[model samples]
Target: MKDNPLIKTLFAGSQPPHLIDPLALFLLVLIPIGALPLSPSEEIHLFLARTSLLIYLGLRSIQGLIWTGRRNRSDGWVTSISWSSSLFLGIGWGFLSLSWSLSPFTSRSVFLDFFLYISVYGLMTQASLPGKTVKTLYQFLVMMALLVSLDGLSQKFYRYDAYLPYLTEHPEKFDPHTLEIMKNWITTFRRISAHFLLPSHLAGYLILIIPLNVALIQLTPTLWKRVSWLLVLGVNLLVLFFTESYGAWLSLLVVFAFVLLYPLVPRLRRLGRATLQEDSPGQTPGRLLKTIPGIILLSAGTFIVLTLIGYSRGTYLWDLNAPDHPGYLRFLNWKSAFLILRDYPWTGTGLGTFKIAYPPYMLPNSTEANFAHNSYLQIGSELGLPGLLMVCLAAITWFLKGLTTLSTLSDPEDRIIYRSLFAAGLGFCLHNFVDYDVYIPALGLTGFMLLGLGGSGNAEEGEPGRREEPSPLRPSPASPFFNIAWPACLLGLSLWLFILNGKLYLVNIHINQVKKEMEQGEFEKAYQIAQKALFYDPGNPSLQEISGVLLLQLKQPERAARAFQKAIELDPKVPRFHAYLGETYLLRGDLAGAYVETKKAVELFPLRTSYQKRLEEISSLLEKYAVKNRKP
Candidate 1:
């Protein structure tokens, strides 16, 4: 009998599947790029892509449970589960923190993203076979690197916004907050973001793919193929340099050092006897030696380019004392993050609460920053020490396991691939210490995908770990109730998430429309649209803030005050909510209330010049009125 249509749709066949098809892998690789849209922020794109991937993986997992007799023999479930448990526990704690989270809505969103990523990790580890998956990944990554690099070059040189076509042509669509960043591209220092939300994000993406491309170059047999891969690598490295992400640049340097030194290490060389002796034809010393001169030349050229750019921009690379310097800002952020972590040592303020919780703790002269610029510190400050430990343990476990596996590999190609993956993982971890590389969806997903591939024991062409034994076509011997119940639960959950994603998309559309209306000076229409949007996502502080602004513009200070108060109640850590409420109070002639609210705003974000200025202006007005009253 043929397999069930539902099972077929999920699994691709009745036979136990070993690997994801290249075509499907190609589609998966494109998710990060294709998810970008103009209507909402980058987070929405991440949400949509993650939701879709999770749903698809959920279906495949259900099918695996029903059709397969046991867990895939190729997947080292014990090792995988050991490391994966840490990740799960960390994320689970994040979900639990929603109850006490500074902003439950933000916590909920973060938890969902982590949940989806975990699902992807499981699906990839179970389904991917070694050779084909690596090949497919390399092909797709090279193409993506080339495409993004070209786009970045065009954007930097031609001042083009790659996302412009996705936006509506209406001038109102060009709102100051979202679209202004796109419009203001011509600065003394132009950093290309490609389609990502920031230049640093593009740098993270390039850093991730660089090692994989290096592996492909090592594996290519033909001269032209090698040259082509090298070209892609060069282009990507060039773009990465122009992104001016110091963390990414440093990470790339570390990766290059690892690759260049690996063969020279006596212990590692001893472990690679099979690759050195049996596969001598493919693993040539001359080929490896050639990379050194090229790497040196590339390094020297990069330094020269950076020096010239720094000179022209009047931003010396060594100038850390500058008020606006990224290094100085990062130092300040780390200091504040440590202070916040000290306050909540057991359980953090909450996941995704760092942005809200950090402003009040910022040092003088430091501006508002969302992330701590250090992933480990950000996680520690947001999710507490326990969560931080779990995440760290998970990463270490994956790296060690992959490195151990690489040490034992006999196949030349397999050894290279595993070494590349391990190096990439190490680079990513190192980069996170100085930058929020892991927060970027494209980079984060790619990192996890590499880990999944590394965990799957089937990377070689003739590896003994491959599942060659035939399996019975019958269903698993587990209870019929489990078989039916599990799939039904998965299907239901998938459907629910899909529905929720659609609703969220609709809400974003409505919010965008409200923004457009407000830009056109249509306060009443904007207020109505915001009210309707709030019906869908009432906890959204943004929509509430919009309603408050519109109400203030309509001369309804009482209603506006209520709106701003509601916004503050939803997310109390935001200074803008308090500032807006203070303005409303001032308009209503409630001087005492106005002073109280404005002072709260200043206390929350003392470094914000505008808030301080507003406070000063109000104080002067009160003094003038007091003088007038005394004279009368």
Candidate 2:
């Protein structure tokens, strides 16, 4: 107990305040257990849970630093070695990403966050209580699953049945120009709640966890233990079906197949096999109870019936082929992503820059898309192949390491747990072939938590070779350095990211609301909200476009023209900027000037027949105006 730095720091130079052993156990086990019931929130207050967890980790890191200082003074080198390796890998990727990103600022920030996550893992590796940390994470995952399951249920049984009114009313804010984006979004999805942003994402999220849930049901020792996992599996699957995301369903099938086949691979022969005697026999009463696959069938049946009922009422099953299904355009987006990759393969357009840059390339006949549905393509287009390769390699390394561990572990329960997690990770990897969930910070954070769980040894039993016999040479489990520093650092970084993400979310929501207000003809409200948005994201060209359009509507053409020019300067590649500028020039009766600008617009977007028509109109007007002036 004295070897763990976190424990030592708390008790150092003071009498024991409480039973340290019990406290350590509680921290290791219960912190994760306590988090199982979270629901996706519209309220900002939910940020507290993340804040608390950060505080907990920060204290742990401090404990580790203090303990290490008192023990062997040479331990700093070990910390430095681990951090250095992580830093080198991270910086290498960051520089490579900078070379390709369309939005270098956003790319750099994401890479920084990615690097911090890697550092956390490295620090975790050096900690003495890795098993406990792992256990804490597993408990956290189980709880998260439970919460998602419950949230999905509420969305189905309560919301769908009652047709619940908007849960939270947002203030209106956005100019008429920006509100145009909302019209397309409103018709895209039937239900757009926090629980399920898009059908595919919901399906993908649940699919990722199916393998883990299955493992829990199969490998857990007691019949009760196995049965407990069924609730989570049942709920998650139910929600997945409700989502009706075909891509997610397809991804799940692929991942589940791989997981089921993983154990049968010849290379896995080294992983010891379970003896026939250990398998529960068919005859025992308790064993018969264990074979109640009937419960699973019933649960599934109930879900299907509920889904059918929901479908009858028009609240279920998103058909990708339906006329109203805007998602069908994803095929074009996918193609465009490849085209963009070909054009800028080395460095991407920039992180978050694809949406801003991709629309002009779309066939003039079709609707514009918000994203290239494929995450890998999106990342590849933004950061280039090297950045993509770096991320892929990191994920592969972590996954294979986890797989190797799972295969070698002796405990059936632990092995099952790992197999399930591996399945979820596999599902996400597959899903990313056609979706961008991996880039979502909230989802990414949860994924990293799961990744941490995958790296953990058995918490209750401790990791192999971690036994304490109390040698003067061997550090005590309670050593201050072993426990404190790493946890503290992790907590601090995690909190900072969470806060940053929360603020970002608020900005997105506010921006969306502002645009809606603009659409409703609330120009004053829209302008007010747009200004506020500008305050938060002054560099956003889209926001500037909105401000410029609104200024034009208010009869400030010169100022509006300047704003349009600025938008072009910010991103000259956008054809609309030229078109808008030409329109502004025409309004000012500068026929020659208008013709020049209009011709530029037509040249930039040849397929836009409207732009060509406008160009012809300007040319004719300029010619007539020149002839009339000569007559004078």
- RMSD for each model, in Å, please? 5.5, 7.9
lDDT of 1 by residue, 415-446 (tens): 77777777777777788888886666677777
- lDDT (tens digit, per residue) of candidate 2 on 1-632: 12343334453522111112324434433332332224434233223434444454455445545545555422331343233343335435555665555555455456544544443344333334433343444455555666776776676556553323232222233223223433322333333222544456556556656665676567556888767778778777777666656567667756655554454443543332322223345344454464345445544664565456346434433564554343556677877887877887776676656765575566544555556888777766776676567667766666556555655656554455556656666676677777776565445444554455454433334232122322335543434553455445545655665555555556566667666776677776776787787777665566677778877777777977887887777667667788888888888877777777777776656666788899888888888888888954
Backbone clashes for every candidate come to: 1, 47
Cα error, residue 48 of model 2, in Å, equals 6.7
Q: What lDDT score goes with residue 503 in model 1?
A: 59
**Alpha-carbon runs more than 4 Å astray in model 2:** 1-92, 95-101, 104-194, 215-229, 268-332, 360-367, 457-538, 574-583, 590-632
Candidate 2 lDDT score relative to the true structure:
0.56
Best by lDDT: 1
Least accurate 10 contiguous residues by lDDT in model 1: 1-10
Shift in Å, residue 607, candidate 2: 6.8
- For candidate 2, the TM-score is 0.67
Clashes of 1: 1
Q: What is the C-alpha lDDT of each candidate?
A: 0.70, 0.56
